[model samples]
Target: MKMTDIEKQVGDFRLRIPQLQLEDGCIHGLIGGNGCGKTTLAKLMMGILTPDSGRIDREGLTGREITMTSQRPYLMHTSVYENVVYPLKLRGEKPEESDIRPWLTRCGLWKKKDQYAGSLSGGERQKLSMIRAMILKPKFIIVDETLSNLDPDSVKLFEQWIREIQEQSAVTWVLISHQLSHIYRMSDQIHFLSQGELVVSGPARELLKNCGEERLRAFLDRESLDRT
Candidate 1:
C-alpha cells in the first residue's frame, strides 16, 4: 500500500522518489505535466517494472491480488462480455452475467456487451478496461490516466461511476491525470509529481487553496484560464 525510497529507470528517464503511503479508504490523485513520471510510478507499484532501488510495500497484495489500468488501455481480442469477465476468470472464478452487468451498465458499456473489445471506441475501451480492473474488487487499484483519453461526455459518465464505486466498495483508488478539473473533482488527496519526484502531497482541498509551489500554482492557474 506504499512505496519506500523507490527508484527506477525507463529508457532515457530516471525516476527517483521517496515512499508514498496511500491513505486507506480514500481516492488519491497524481497530477503532473507530461514526462513527470506519473505513469512510471504507477507501473512500478503494479510490479510491471522492477524498482532499481528501494521497494514497494504492499502489505495485502501478493502479486495475484493487484490490478491496474494504463493510459493507453489494454483490451483482449474478445467480446466485451469476455473482456469484462477475464479478471474473474484469471482468479479461477466463474464469470457471471449478474456480476458483470452492473459494472458494464455503470461504465456505459452494457449495450456493447457482445461486441468485440478491439472494436470499441477509445472511451468505450477505457471503460471496458476499468470494468476489467474493478471486477475483481482488489484491495487497491492503480489507474494510470484512465480518463484522460475520453470525450467530455464519456468522462462525465466515468466520474459518476467512480463515485458510485467508492460509495459501494472499500477499494482504494489511485489515479493519475494531467486534467486539473478531474483531480479537483475526484481526489480526497493529491500528489504532485515533478520529473519523477513527489514534489508535494496533501489534502486535495487545502493543497488546491494554498499549494505554495510555483509549478503547482501555474498548473492551477492554467486550469482556471482554460475553463474561461
Candidate 2:
C-alpha cells in the first residue's frame, strides 16, 4: 500500500506526509502522542475521512478488500455467533458454524459462541471484534488499539490468534496503538506521529531502540499509555 504526498486538516491539527511505503503481508506499527493523527491517518486510509490534499493510492489493492477494527469495537446486541458471522451474512453468504468455529476457537471464544455478545468482558468483546474482522480475510486490515482494553493474559491470547490468522491468510496489517510493547513485539515497520505530523517511519525494533527523538524515546520507554 502507498500514499502519495497526502495532507489532511482536522480542526487545528494537520497530518502531512510526502509518502508512506508499506511492504506486503507485514505488520506495520503506528505510534504517537495523544491527538497526533494515528487514528486519523487510519481513517484516511479507510476513506472514512477524506484528505485535504494529495492522494492515497492503494497500490495492488484494486480488487482486494480493506477493513479495520477500531479501539472501541462495534458488536451488535446478539449472540457471539451472530456477531462474528454477520459480515458473511451481510454479503449474501451463509453463516456457517463450521467455517466460523476455527476463528472462535483461535480467539478462545468457542465456548462462548452461544452466549450474548454484550455480556462478554472488554477483552472478550475485543476478541469478537478481531474474529469478525479476520473472518472476512481482507487483503489489508487496520487494527486501531484493539489490544488496549485487554489484560496481560488476554493480550497474549489475542496476539497468538492474530499471528495465526496473519500467517494463514498472508494479509498486510496496520496496527495503531498507544502500547509500545505491542508495537515492538508485532510490527515489522513503524510510523511515528507527533502533533499530527509524521515524524519518522522505519524498521520497528530499530525505531524503538535507536530513535533519538525525545518524545518518541519517552513514548517507547513509558510502561503504559492511555488508550487514545
Candidate 3:
C-alpha cells in the first residue's frame, strides 16, 4: 500500500506524510514516542480514519482483507473457543474443532478453550485476540502494541508463529510499538515518526546503524540507555 501527500489534523496535532510505501509481504515497523501519531497513522492505513488530504492506495484490498489488533483487543463475553471461531462464523463458515484446536494449542490456550474469555489474564486475552485475527487469514494486518502484555516467553512464541505464517503466506504486517527491541527484531523495514512526521524510514539494520535524523538518533540512544 502507498500513501501520497497524506495529511490529517486533530486539534493541535497534525500528521503529514509526503510519500510512504508499505511493501507487500513484509513486516514493517511503525515506531514513535507517546502521542507521536503512531496510532493515528495506523488508523489511516486501516481506513478507520480518513486523511484530510491525500490518497491511500490499498493495492485493491477490501475491508474484509484487512485486520487490526490493539493492545486492548475486544473479546466476546463467550468462551475462548467461541471467541476464536467468531470470525469464521461471520464468514458463514462452520469450522470444525480441528480447525480451531491448533490455534488454541499454539497459544497455550487449549486448556482454557471452554473457559470464559472475560476471565482470562491480560496476556492470555492478547493471545486469544491474535488467534482470532489470524483465523480470518487477512491479507493485511496492523498490530498496535499487541505484544506489550505478553511475557518474554509468550513474545518469543508469538514471534515464531508470525514468522512461520509469513513463510507460508503473502501477508503484509504492520507492527506499531514503542518497544524498539521488538521492532528491531521483527521488522524488515522501519518507519520512525516524530512530532507527527515521518523522520526516517529504511531497512531496520540500516536505520539502526545510521539514522540521519537527530531526533530519532537521540530517541534510540535513550532507549539503549534504558535497556542498560
Per-residue lDDT tens digits of candidate 1, residues 1-228? 778888888998988878688887789988878898988888887888889999787877777767799777877888999887877877889967887788888767888899988998887788778778877777788888878898888888877877877888756788887777887788899888878788888898888877788888887787672322
The residue ranges of model 3 lying beyond 4 angstroms of the native Cα positions read 225-228
TM, every model: 0.91, 0.89, 0.96
What order do candidates take by TM-score, descending?
3, 1, 2
Number of the top lDDT candidate:
3
Deviation in Å, model 1, residue 59 alpha carbon: 1.9
lDDT of 2 by residue, 10-44 (tens): 88888897888878889999888788888889988
Query: How do the residues 95-190 of candidate 3 rate in per-residue lDDT, one tens digit apiece?
Result: 999988988998799999999999999999999888888889999999999999898899989888899899999689999877778888889999
Which wins on TM-score, candidate 1 or candidate 2? 1
Candidate 3 weakest ten by summed lDDT: 219-228
Instruction: After superposing candidate 2 on the true structure, give the runs of residues whose Cα lies further than 4 Å from its correct spot.
Output: 62-64, 222-228
